[model samples]
Target chain A: MSGNSEMSPRRPRLAVWKLASCDGCQLTLLDCEDELLAVAGAVDIAYFREATSAAVDGPYDLSLVEGSITTAADARRIREVRAATTTLVTIGACATAGGVQALRNLGDIDDFKKAVYARPEFISTLATSTPIRDHVPVDFELRGCPISKRQLLETLSAFLARRTPNVPTESVCLECKRRGNVCVLVAHGTPCLGPVTQAGCGAICPAFHRGCYGCFGPQDTVNAPPLLTELQQLGLSPPQLERLLRTFNAEAPAFRAAAESLGAGGEK
Target chain B: MTERTIAVDYLARVEGEGALRARLDGDRVEEVELRIFEPPRFFEALLRGRSFEEAPDLTARICGICPVAYQMSASHAMESALGMHVTGTLRELRRLLYCGEWIESHSLHIYLLHAPDFLGFPDAVRMAKEFPEVVARGLSLKRAGNHLMEVLGGREIHPVNVRVGGFYRAPEREELEALRPELEKALGLAAETVRFASGLEFPDVEEDYEFVSLVHPDEYPMNEGLIRSSRGLEIPAARYEEEFEELQVPHSNALHSVRRGGGSYLVGPMARYALNRTRLLPKTRALANDVGLEPVVTNPARSIIVRSLEVHYACEEALRILSTYRRPEAAFVPPPATFEGGSGAAATEAPRGLLYHRYELSRERLIERARIVAPTSQNQKRIEDDLRHLLERQIRADDATLTDACERAIRHHDPCISCATHFLTLEVDRR
Candidate 1:
């Protein structure tokens, strides 16, 4: 068996999609100010409305989807996007863990809508904002409120090279230790999610003298119950701890379960 | 007589999801809708009960393109409620940080999003193939802004350093010094950008825009000022709800803002420039005049020029702030020891337009309510009005051309619907 010699290989076609998001994750790709032009050269960039007006019909090689699926149109659109892409990677907390907006998933969406909009009847939305994986199969998940640009570049590089992306799934505590920053939780009595929150944001909140609010979702081996207990001991009440865990990557399984276990319930 | 509808299901290039629909009934434009389909994030609702300290981080999530706007408005509002203001160096640093956003956001719009439309490319990558130097300059200018943010606020996209009173930490003078050369280069590039933007082919369209912006007595408005309009209306930020009201229209999730009983108004660079042109630094003012920009420009398409002028001003301002840099004794001012509560409102000039945040805090300093009015929401009605005007003027153009031209008109506003739908998407239907 041999590869076809007559046809030349083409750059991988990349499509960036947004559903319900802050546009930060995709902006991360553009925020690669040094590498943006080079990255553009390596990919076809078939469809990315936020960055370009040029759109190509897709059967894309790789699709980086941002935002959670929160509307009826988006639900159908994700299926269409999935059908049109060979490998679909969901980027950011919204796409992977339902984002900050996912707080509505636990509450009455109507009340949420009414609270935000004066005439809620005019608004169209799903009852809950859910992750991309909830609607369609995702090949990979890149976590962050706005994903780390380095990780994003790596993920894109992996797609271009047809290699497995090397993204760590360790807790933020490990990252904090690696950076040699003193533990805000252990040393300063600050209630932090570093114990269970996934690494990637470089322990940013902790480095800033604040507790990690878990923008990167949960680590692979998250036992958030223990972290919640620890937080309670550090002066965070059950309600405060629940609100803390339920931000950014709020609906992640480990964090959600922990919040529920603390009697915060599914309805925030 | 063709009675047809032209619909754009999703607007490209502009930030966030939104659609535009225009219906023509036998050459008469019957209906024009700037449909903002960006899914609602319910930020105003979710902010309730959160600590007032968290407002900056939370509201910053509204728009990746202009997080500083949200952060500034939030911090200012919270500061007002707490009965404190970041004084001297702290205030200057906040202004410096805003200049970074102005540079970044404006450059992104001018080079990547809006420029491509004028240059007849699908996006900047394609445009770069033709105008590499221009694109590179824009990116460099944008990076300078990002570098400033990184040094001051930690990161560019969603800066984590900002709090209610000030930043978590301030940049060292040496750290700021390192950014000077790059910003100097950006200053030159921004000047060239003004010349380039002024040279773009603009449609012969102008509107009697009721421009609104914050105007500080002594400086260009960014963080603090009374909300003033071209219509001679002046109000404190607290009176924002009274002067301007949001209409819950069926076509968009984001409410359409109007001047109480009046019509649409313009904001952002054009508004800021038109209303506060006298306050611009000499170099920035020279660049604007060199480009033949009038003190009060009404052509919507020429907003690109205004943004370029702003980029020039921002770079200069950033440099001035950096050169006079004295790190504050403390990174942030602590709130008052007393536990009394109050409500406060603030309007800041986001790169795109005005961003207003009104917060009602409890005695315990928890946010009882949050009312955020992003610029895009305020500009939505105006955008539709512009489209309607465009259709009336170019009613006879081919469908493709009309759609392309309409998209261009919307781009002039550089509408960050993401800011609004939370803010946008575009659809055009002609029947």
Candidate 2:
């Protein structure tokens, strides 16, 4: 908890890992232009493949893991991450839920890959992209396509403090209502996932007068079925309801279950 | 003779995952492979069955730094698919947004990533220790660009405010005015950046390049322009596929692109500068000349100067857009779509290079086929060609020197391989 870089010599070594998602999440650390140098003061930066060539041996104090476990290699790699770090924080939707790419978990991944590649045999992957928690324990999970910058800063701050980061587990409605933004769904009759989706992103979509598409995944407790019923009453067909749930955080358990049940034949 | 490899296990000072492998046969320069091993996301595959509306969000995942490029290009292509023509204020806003991307992306590369190689620093953070003012200017310039993106697109990366037809929300007049002070300051920094880069000690490396870019009339190309190059090649954006082709290289998952019958070509800052130097506003063009960068020049090593000049141009253009800002009533106009009968292809000048996207949407509006040609891919063979010749010159230099030379050569273009398997691996071999 002390801010002494020299006196408290064990400057907790940090390592960043990536799996089946964009490198944006880890780049958030590098993109910390204002605090990058000071950040290096707090950590040995033992291994961050995205940033530097200087890497040290790690039974790291902190490991910031990005991306989801999509391939079998990633599934195996998460174990190595958990083994290497005392505190493992998974950042972004890919690491927490299966990410937007996890939409394949709803269908056949092999078929998906084959449809894209000329030689699908060359590709190696698992049929599903699952969250980091599915394979190994994650000390914390930061949610977003690339994770929020403030959240990342807080998470790093917490690790340095040896306390849980102050990430709210509430719904997007709270952030939206706090921002005093008009409800896109309530006022404009837009079918939004804000009611079921988690906070963070400052309820960004709704603040801009657009309904939430839930880039931040589900809240700690979401009644997705009830939300689906609301969407249905607002004139969503069964497939329309399914498509709504099966986006961004499609592999998150509640949304995943909601997608399957809603996508079924004419679920009127 | 013993074989020595100057290997950078993970490529730094570049965008995305890549490695370089240089084979040395007693300094004869056997082969140099810029291996791009970044995992593929199958964006083109995921795009299928997706509404043309989803293209921006889906394809934006291809690269983080150049997400705006992906979004703009995808939006333009899909808009074309719908037989929509956007112009006036809406079109100007798109160009202004692109100017922001160019300034941010170019300054980041020219200062933080590419400049260090020339300045003999490991990275910009280290370079700041010696040249704090320069690095500060660079960050400020980059911040100005991010501010523009935030004001317009919402977030700097994979901005959510963008939709197929237009923005989910349009910036108000005050939002555009808020950017003016920062932009005016950015203009000064951009000029200083050119002076800094143009004065950098460049290792002598130049090659014959088929320079490619989007050329426009009365404006430096950004969002809307015809694809053209210094080699007298001209094609409408719609003919990008017919003019250029992509082929899978053995060492990469991303395909290399070239002129249909030609060997290799250059894109990105250097190429854009050489091809469209005249189109730049008076001040930026003057900066190019004052910095000893004449369009007729053939020095690839001096590409840094070109990128810096672009930083100047982008800053100036952004300020112009801001000063003349009138908040449009609508962010986008819904254009009509006539499917099957019409095929649309368009290329935009992404910060990296000319990003081309073409689609054959069937009558049912399902994507029948998709073609994407990233700037990194277009520059691949040209990079290898540069490596072969540049390393040959440094054949007598020590392994470290020669290897660094090769890395510098590849980084000169600021390649982003994520768009290709996606961008750089640094390997140096000497005998």
Candidate 3:
């Protein structure tokens, strides 16, 4: 590792930038506590404002940007961030697809801001929050509300090694079955989003004896029709299933159709 | 004569987006700022139409590090407005889960994040290379806290079991009893953390500011207490807005809070430590005195030591609760969300500091309006004050000295930016 970092000719400075989402995706980096020392030894963090006061000049080799571009200014900020980096990888559902805050995209942004701030006029934000790809060309996207730490480290390692990261794009239901956990829908009649949601977070909810809530965004090429049918089978009226899909990963295509099928917008 | 700006564009090992900046004009320091530029999600606006029951889950997203505190505060407010007492094992279970949060969040901050700053390192990962044993010990302690939450709340991040009135489910006695060994191991690690923090190089900067935290007569405040400040101001949680008020500044979208009289007061570890020193677990109390941590004086800079002391207390508290943990006869009390008219506020001790929630529930059981004053928000003004004070110390020092001082200043408050990210532009004009 020392020889690799030294003989790599030039250390690619990495900058972590945030947009609009839960801080969880960025937190995954720190959450990799055990592997952090090893990871730092490999990469030269040129501009990670979340972690250090010191800055090394950055025309970064790689930029791992978290969150979605939500405001008009953030829409501008992404271009500046993209210009300074060679490879731009978006991490988390927020950056790849619009995050939970995208729920505001379906509603009124001015009405939303006014409800929260005493002086809503002071806030400068866009009517919609969209993924970084809408604003700039993204090299890669590691999906999930808070991207898994192991997956993050693996992505970093792959980027450094000049190889594609070994990330699975299968549905969480596949992993849930691989772990030999019983299907809650088959046995307990509990509706689950696992069949359509991405395979990450280790199928956390199912392991905890609850159905998946799809916090990790949707899986690749998801079959949403069957799941909506399952929700109906489990006694969820159309409105209930609509509310369920419109949570954290609301704006993803598969979830959007499921919500629309039930005849509703992204509100309770 | 030279004028220079010391800027830390990012702070490492801590949660959320934070940067520290200061300007030195020759031998005089012009301005200092602690800025939170984390991306904004506008949660307050989103919650306007969400169901009252959804508040716990929705607001929990505010901080991944301290979701439990948000859930607790929101739940209590909702329950109170619904005119109900969440009595029996459910109440005890809530306390136990809070203890888990205290253990996890405290250990994570005190050892992994804040300790390295005192020891002259770039981050915890750097510090860990020299202190492997300490890092390992801290992880297991942290793991124990997450484990406790997993068992009780369903998952560590945005736990599922908690609801407005009670949990959806409860763990059996055998499952609850299984955590004893983990708690035991955590206690050992906590003791080591005390020694480790005690060994760090603490700068000789102390302040005589006011310490504000929740205090309960029966215990070191966890779920409920009378809001108290070191300046001798005490009031019920219902009167929290009256005492501590948030002001919106034109420079930033985030609100800066202060005690009603005008002076900024601190929250989190130092505040909690001073206000509830006597109520600390026995072993933790002894360790505080052992480490030479005197609860006297409100030095925001020295709060790191106090944070370490509180970690000791949290570990001890976790162990106590785990050992005596009894599954209450009932997991939770039923909700009375149909109250005609009720207004209530709730305050809970988060891993960082006091988290306050106020709600006005209408007869229909939907929320008319809600106000959430997070611990990180209350501590913002205090953090800026620390920056201003620390800059005075490094007035004669170089850019590097001022930069480190700015780091130290922000570290004093241990700002969590996900909650405060809606606002900030820290400018230190040297001219």
Q: TM-score ranking from best to worst?
A: 1, 2, 3
- Give candidate 1 regions above 4 Å deviation: A1-7, A264-267, B423-431
RMSD of 2: 2.8
What does the lDDT read for residue B272 in candidate 3? 84
Clashing pairs in model 3? A49-B10, A50-B11, A51-B11, A51-B12, A52-B10, A52-B11, A52-B12, B207-B299
lDDT of 2 by residue, B198-241 (tens): 77776555578888988888788888788887878888888777
> Quick one: ranking by lDDT, best first?
1, 2, 3
Candidate 2's displacement at residue B388, Å, is: 1.5
Report the C-alpha displacement of residue A56, candidate 1, in angstroms.
Answer: 1.5
* Global CA lDDT computed for model 2: 0.76
- Identify the superior model by lDDT, candidate 1 or candidate 2: 1
Candidate 3 docking category?
acceptable
TM-score of every candidate: 0.96, 0.94, 0.90
- lDDT against the true structure, per candidate, is 0.87, 0.76, 0.75
TM-score between model 1 and native: 0.96
Q: How displaced is residue B229 in candidate 3, in Å?
A: 2.0
